[model samples]
Target: MLASWQMREGFLRSGRMATRRGVWVVALALGLAAGASAGEEFEGKLTFEVVSKQAGAQPVAMDYTVKKGLVRMDTKVAGMSNYTIIDPAHKKMSMVMPAQKMVMEMAIGSVEPPAPATAPEIVKTDKTERVTFNVVDATTLTLVKEGEAAGAGAKTYEGQQYAVKVGDRNSEQWIAKDLTLLAGFVETFKAMAQGPNAAWMKRVEWPGFPYRMVTKDAEGNVLSEMTLVAIDTKSPDDTLFTVPDDYKKMTMPQAPPAMPKE
Candidate 1:
């Protein structure tokens, strides 16, 4: 049986933005809105699908709706539905659990406790590639670099792909040129922009959002993958960003009192 941290590490190894339930929301929010114009606000929905090849890992689908700087993210885990609402204007984030009918709220960019004493070593390699993907339709995308039909007659996004090594895990990230709504939606709701890895992550200066990411172990076995599935420009309803009246709100869990000094 895998310990909780082991499972979490597996998710990280697969190139997830962070650990825990709100990870994807945090990761996708980071650097997402840097390109939008003030006069042209983005109000739409974006969906992503995460697939994990690691043992005991389940696929996850994330749906994000952005409106007037308010963002709502929805996903299901093990048949249970969960939601995260980010109100950047208020600098707050809310986690809604449907089954429990409870909501936990916290300020955005809250600092987490320090990690273990020894930080993992990470390195960026010199390898680079031009990845091309054929947009089959509004909801379909095919990786043309991987031998798809040459005559698909579709629009394509040329991706700047690069590799990075985090300890024993190797990951390849395919970043597409910043698209207005897609980039703006994420940047507006970024929750944890300055974490343990913020310095290193920002140092690279991603010219765009990473559309596809694949992580593999030292022995070259794939552990997980996350891909951009679709982007919907249709405006989402205001109700999707609001908390239901019947749901109870919960406070943050306080730590136990520290032991007496010797």
Candidate 2:
């Protein structure tokens, strides 16, 4: 059985912005509204689907809601639902289990980016494609380069957000163009650089959210993947950003002690 931290580390470092139950949302919304209402936070809803051939895991839906730097994610276990909230500004993360009515929280530390200029380079291609899904019409877009992988079709604002439209049934987002939303990413990437994922992480250089990514193992077997399915831009209820009043706070369990190094 995989330990909790093992599972969570991937979700966190993989640049997850939010998630949910039965319809997982994976969003990274960085924004500056163009003709959009002022004081508008980058609210977004998305569904994430994961397929793994090696693990033989059933395709499960994870939903996400994101606004500003706050994220609300939902998941389930044994038919019971669990929710997690990540607040980058406060540097905290909490897990709430509805069935148990319990809430567990942990304090997180922030990381500094290597350079403000270390952002992704973008260039337009002649290729064009239409992307559509729930609530979003058939929006045509042009492919842009991020690095080796070239599959982003988005309309750009001078120095604001990128409204990406990619393929049918996939969600779109307004990825932040500034350094504000990169705090969590900075921490995750810093960890990746020091961890085993260093080489792989450095090679890709994905600037913002990845709407759809398919990862395969060395033997060419599909390891796992996460893709966007749905999206919305309306601000979610404020309650979604906090622990429910019905849930009680619970102390997190401590890890087992490490063995002596000898």
Q: lDDT (CA) for every model shown?
A: 0.57, 0.41
Q: State which candidate has the highest TM-score.
A: 1
Q: Encode model 1's per-residue lDDT on 120-231: one tens digit a residue.
A: 4544445455544456566444445455564456545556776766555566767666443355543443322233333334335556666777778788888778776666
Name the weakest run of 10 consecutive residues (lDDT summed) in model 2.
22-31
| TM-score of candidate 1 on Cα atoms, chains taken together | 0.65
Candidate 1, superposed: residue stretches over 4 Å from native: 1-19, 23-41, 110-154, 178-199, 253-262
Candidate 2 per-residue C-alpha lDDT over 1-262 given as tens digits, one digit per residue, 9 for 90 to 100? 4765664554343222221110111111111111012433445555556566655467656666666667777654345456777665665567666655556665543321133222333333233333223223342222232332333343332222222222111112223223232223322221222112222233443455444444444444555655555545456788798887876564432211111110
91, model 1: CA deviation in Å?
Answer: 2.4
